[model samples]
Target chain A: MDMGKGVGLVETKYITVASHPHELTLESGQHFGPVEVAYETYGELNQRGDNCIIVPHALTGEAHVAGRHTPEDRVAGWWDELIGPGRALDTNKYFVVAANVIGGCCGTTGPKSTNPETGKPYGADFPLITIRDMVQVQYLLLKNLGIRRIKAVIGGSMGGMQVLEWALMYPEMVEAIVPIAASGRLAAQCIAFNAVQREAITGDSDFKGGHYYPGPGPIRGMGLARQIATITYKSDESWASKFGRTFSSIRPQDYYSLDNRFEVEHYLDYQGEKLVQRFDANTYLYLTKAMDLHDLGRGRGEYREVFSRFRGKVLSIGVSSDFLYPKYYQEEIHHFFKQAGADSHYWELISPYGHDAFLIEFKKMSLKIAQFMQTLS
Target chain B: MDMGKGVGLVETKYITVASHPHELTLESGQHFGPVEVAYETYGELNQRGDNCIIVPHALTGEAHVAGRHTPEDRVAGWWDELIGPGRALDTNKYFVVAANVIGGCCGTTGPKSTNPETGKPYGADFPLITIRDMVQVQYLLLKNLGIRRIKAVIGGSMGGMQVLEWALMYPEMVEAIVPIAASGRLAAQCIAFNAVQREAITGDSDFKGGHYYPGPGPIRGMGLARQIATITYKSDESWASKFGRTFSSIRPQDYYSLDNRFEVEHYLDYQGEKLVQRFDANTYLYLTKAMDLHDLGRGRGEYREVFSRFRGKVLSIGVSSDFLYPKYYQEEIHHFFKQAGADSHYWELISPYGHDAFLIEFKKMSLKIAQFMQTLS
Candidate 1:
């Protein structure tokens, strides 16, 4: 049952999906290229090559989908428990590949990558990319690796957006998909949340127009932005259950000062501080913008037209307590797919973790995914 | 149907709830006094001086409850829709009074007031006050005005917190209470939201340790804080319906720039900018802290013990779409008051305005409040 021992140690590999000067024309009419995709693969692809499954990571996630980087690594990949041999994806029976999306700040080419034109990090110079653009990059990676037909593509949050995008763009190549806690088009409130987060980052005096490459680079603003994201990621019920009026410490004086912390405040600060240490603020800005602009039917006609192109089987998983991407979006995904006469189903996972339920409520999510994967045949 | 003629022009008046040298010991074990309460009245006190309805204003609200400050004033008070002659409170039939809470920046004695000890603005030096302390000051105001009792105490959001506090503190003096979108004790998530808003104000470089008087006083940070508040004040469905995918303007370049914004972001910036112009950053810090510290049973007893002392009739009004203070809190308020054997009824207003429903969906809220008021007579 141990995922680490089950999958063993894994190594991340990188490939330039689009070599320099060979631009990948994006959905935004911008030519972005020399794109790199960092990914990890588990299990053999099999002789027929029909057993491949793609795992896409969410915002702020890297290409590592399961297993430890090294035997000594303390943390496995984000979806370690839900993947691996004998698990939902069942690495023993299927070949799985998880790649970092374009415009990501991992081992992939993103705002942090050097611009061929200037020899400096792209930063805000990175062109705005959409969910379809990210899916295109994934397609390039798969094609380069000679993995033709996908058994299924699965992910949550931004990853889920990618999953749906893949099915829409390549219904013939991908057979099944599971999109969890994603939106067809982001709600106005969600866009507003993203807007404020970007505002905090840019509002910081240290932001330096996204050119502060060597300096600390808007750490405080990014921290505040992360804090806001953390608040929305979880359910109000979960926060109440976890932190509920508790002071940060037993110190009496901490209760009287504005600077003093609540237990929840301390948790948020830790989350903020942690992300700021590893993330580039410009990437945060770009990725959030991508999310804000994530409309499935944009430039692609109406909902009926968008759903008509996809004939893949779908399992849309929604989290009942999700605040950011409510369960309704997934239900909408299923409803539209069904209306288009495509094979589609939806399961709203009842949880207290809000939009983060897919990540935190691993056991429940694993069960649902495993049941659905079993039916994929 | 003309609200202007219904209530007519009204003037705000101020009274010192506590004179110099007469310190009111606070919940924090700090002595804070010489407190002034700013208020406005409509109609007249009856022969028995008991036909008075106290309208406790919410956070960032003022003593101006209804009517215009001047006949030519562009905007009426926050609750002008529900407080005119033929409205819910019905000024033609009942005397209605609204007071600014302490720690507020309105006309009340708050962080903006001059501290007698230092002869400067209190700023963050203002003692950490609680909902109970605000209620106590209101009690003093009624006593000084020679009004013996309140026919009912009504409010929404923070005002609702005050409504609950009034019934708990002086049960014999307040005949009835209507707490809309309030909590028995604030949810931990609500406290976390307050914490972040305070952090933004205090984290600002120009805050100068909360003594940024004579300067712009953390306008950027306060603006960001207000923007965050505005998002929470609205429902997701409302935002989708109101500003979905709309650009700030018709500028073609706005679609490509991170600095350029969506229609929702533009609206939020306007809200933030407007608030920063009128509000003091230090008061924002102090008032939110007071709210975070609001606990019905704090320094008193268990909720059952506290509610046992209040015999006032209760009408707890919940808002179905309120993000900040969800309807569940109001329902919880009703549950506790009823369990204590107090005359309590719960009503959840279904509106898409979220927490702002009480302030915006006035016709629906009016029907409920007016019916409740009718029962009181």
Candidate 2:
């Protein structure tokens, strides 16, 4: 099963996997069976098969993290700048892989996918999964591809959570890991944000629990949640700079009625609407819960003990303005890595984008991740 | 018409006329009938009548801005600090007066007030009023008291707006004016906040467009609006300082379902519930609209020209952390006052309470106003 392809625009037949059933037992004791993992690949696998990178995404992100080679898929990838030729990760140099995480809306087995038991969408019956469970499924995906190990794993925020999980769960398999804008455990504030987001969805009259799938399950509530979350993701300074008290020049004939004509309000509406269109509501609930439950040292006791499990070199990055998971959190992980005697490096990316800094300030973040990987080489 | 008593608190009376109406013709080619103003008084008026101090209430404040003697009405006034004996605007020293604006819930002519024509609450039928109109009513109240002139007029936020109007509309009547945490005109952001608040109420299904008096007009929506407004009233710094992220020690074991357990969540719920209890939804709409339309120079043209009309001594105080109406707004007014060659002074109060700083830091503000008034004397 040497399902590997050479470096190019990633239009190769690398994504086709023989139809197979992969079971994922969740944290809630219920089992999710026959999962399909959709992935894409770039760059050549070396003869030794060592130069490989697994790019895990945050919630609602698709496997289309790069490229626009195919005419049908001409749309640019979510991370085109960081993953393309001569830039950061440099697809011309290293084999980069990105897979839609299990229990995702993006081509992966999720609530939206058909359940074999009943020919309908899994809907609310989908078993709740933890970050570790998602990682285990990813591990299985890699195993099926005849890939024994990864040279490095790079991701930020929830992506970073996956990287941490990968490093700890498969110590020998991961040579290096970069976790950006991530924390060892979700803070109470982070959990609170999630709780509110969940409540917004559940609070809506249209939302009959998770059963309002055939119709709309609290789209407005979900939009409101995203609007609130968007506020937290960006810095206050950014909002002040861009939209500070300025209304759009465009005016409706009846301006007396309550309507959002401000640039910031429009911006929030766009963000909220786009999110609602692309993201499944149930997946948001499940993934947020995963992030909340994620503490590398949960059963392992202390952080040192958790770090001790990871034999891989750690390269962690934090954003200066990311109040959600501040720089202190990355520093704590760095200290643990150092104490655990791992070849660890820590860096802080000074960006005003806050928690979304990794996504927005890609040029700076890419250089740092590339440099760290080059050092590993 | 000379309604005067000796200069003492005992001589002052808490005048409560539930729906005192007076008909008036508007400059907008509109004739509105029987508008009511709820009001209260403190201290005694001298025969010479040069000791009156009109204390305007802030947004959402009623005529009960000072102490209520009766046990049933014993709730301390919003600004009790400035009204007591030997205090800043000492009741023993000055005759104090406060009034519920035309479009208010408490004993004033508002949406909730009965329409003399139909015996139903005015509700949405209450014609729109400008801050100038509010000032006009206050002027009548003053004349009705047989007070030819006020020694000083002091107020904060919306009250400050009224104070500015008083100085402009009746320059000779006002000897000195203290406008705190306010601007000549509501800023774009301020208007935007008000718009959101109005939307929260109107967006609710239960809101029958101010005609919900038959039942109730969306208590949940009103609550949500209050929650949002409360956030703006205080700075994020204040919330972090007061209740960062703390859950009660003993969880309400019975509340295992949805309703929040976190202190911050509870705090928000309490604030929302408290506001809905006292406030009329329709009144909230009308008053906020008036606040939005409150530009002192809207029809009067340029800033300086409108401000030049004020010959009274102005003592303007702005809060450092009030993002709602920032210090820059006060500076704008101060610049106009300076440019107009008006007798004016501006003070910036440094407080972490933000817009609500005026109410919470009343003692400090009272001292500043008292000292300024004494200088005029």
Candidate 3:
């Protein structure tokens, strides 16, 4: 098992994958060739290989989900709090694995990843992927690791989408699933936010239709997109308290001109510029499109019939202030499970951090999740 | 008496210089040239010419404040609500006059106006203007119209800024003032919002640095800027009740595929595109920047000292829900007036419409305004 990035003091064997040839046959009867999957593992697989936990990441998250295993990279793992020694998932007892989604900027075979055939970045040449495709790739990764069943499929946000897919696609292969701060499908507001972000990128002259890498890549446009995203990620109440009527420099140098002043404006600029450095514009576009297409049980027939595919226990968590994947979405999930006759539990966690509550309020949330998982025994 | 746009149908007299020379030396010590001003007359000026009431316009508002008497190009006025008839400013009793400012696109010499020197659109060649420069041009326009002492100065938003400037610049010529939904000085947050909007326009590749006319002129970027402005125009509670998680698009067009689904996405796109048709991107930038530089007290010393210049009766009205120019801004005016020993009345009107209440809640606000003006008797 491999320890994750950002966490220190852990010992584990890391599962490695060779550059194996990958082929994906899509719903359109089309086939994609020369695919590669990049993933990292933590903790250890038990004798039955049934103690494994899987985490799917959000739009920008990489495969590094738990500890700071890479000494050179100093950033903390995305889920450092929930998966560690004696923590929520308790890496001491259960194995954990997280993969960079197939179409991501990370090491996964995404837009940023090189096309083996062309010897250049896939860019827009990569076909648009659905959530089902991502889940299928993760399943292949698990098979490569010799794991037949997952003790629990767990994730939040986009990660949570994968958790739902795992439960439905291979019911007996997953005993329990925890989908946190996620929705069964992308609502109108979510799609709207993503559209604005995409416009910010596509409208930029530097974008070049997602092929402007090696040169400048619409950083300002991408920043504006991030600015829009930043607004939805947090609550309005947060902005009121943080900015209000604060003033700023009017023309940069004038001290007393009373010009170009407002704290919210500065905050937005900072948010836009910061995302430009850490994220790629094309990746943002593709991942958001993936999120917009995510619907757990849409194809199997009615929502009830689709949810009935999963016969295992399920735990769904939502944050009170998460307007993105709101509590109402979680309520819908609970209703679907109940109607499907699955033993499902739904919990709401109160936090003022908005959609980011899953990460910030992880202490209380982690305890609840740990307790729920222990009940699976 | 002149008929303001929406005011009572009165036959007003006006003359267009058609070739009026504009341009003034800015406080920045730069010479700006080739200017124009559009004006209309209400009741004839008395022999002493002291009954004149100078009415300034707000953001995006033209100086057609009353009805038009000319049969050639008849256009209704913008302020038909508060002028003419037995309304707040009875035209029969007072000599009312209004003029389009120097930097406005409405009939005045602005960026869109042909530069007499070059006979081409001024575009960005127009010198950057200060609020003081705008007031000075209005002063020049009034001088050319053979006006001396004025009875009063009134306006809201940008117009409010002019009213405050008139009081400070030519206190003795003003007898009374009404400033609605205005601020003492532009705050930091206000400036920041304006800055971001300007950035959005100039950052667009199609903007051509304000020269993209006869073409689209970065309409998409302008639309995005307006969307941002629209968000600030209304209160948080209003948006919450109006939008919530409701689908933004009533008809799903499948514009981008299943990945780009949502009503809010479509709503914002429609709104952003709609604004580009009605608004000029450069004009928007210039006007917002003017508002950013509007501070009657800036560099002129203390705010109280600036208020001391207004030796007249003052009435300041603010809307309770107006976050743009909050009620506290009204209180600031009231405080400054009290310190200056000027007779002043301040009223806060409770309304849910926010900054827009000044325009919508006329019934309640007009009563307070009329009563205050009567007290000046």
**Predicted structure with the largest TM-score when compared to the true one:** 1
DockQ of each: 0.71, 0.14, 0.16
Give candidate 2 regions above 4 Å deviation: A1-61, A69-75, A94-104, A109-200, A229-272, A284-377, B1-31, B45-59, B72-75, B81-83, B115-119, B122-140, B146-197, B233-261, B287-376
lDDT of 1 at A320: 87
Per-residue lDDT of model 2, residues B135-213, tens digit only: 8777777777778869888888889899888888888778888888888876655665665566567756678777888
For all candidates, the clash counts are 0, 2, 39
TM-score of each: 0.97, 0.75, 0.69
lDDT of 2 at A291: 75
* Maximum-DockQ candidate: 1
**Which stretch of 10 consecutive residues in model 3 chain B shows the poorest summed lDDT?**
B1-10
Question: Any residue pairs clashing in model 2, and if so which?
Answer: A7-A43, B20-B36
Chain B alone: TM-score in each candidate? 0.96, 0.90, 0.86
Candidate 2, residues A136-230, lDDT tens digits: the string is 87787777767876989989888999999988889889999999888887665566556556655655567676777678676876776676577
* lDDT of model 3, residue B294: 78
Distance from true location, Cα of A184 in model 1, Å: 0.6
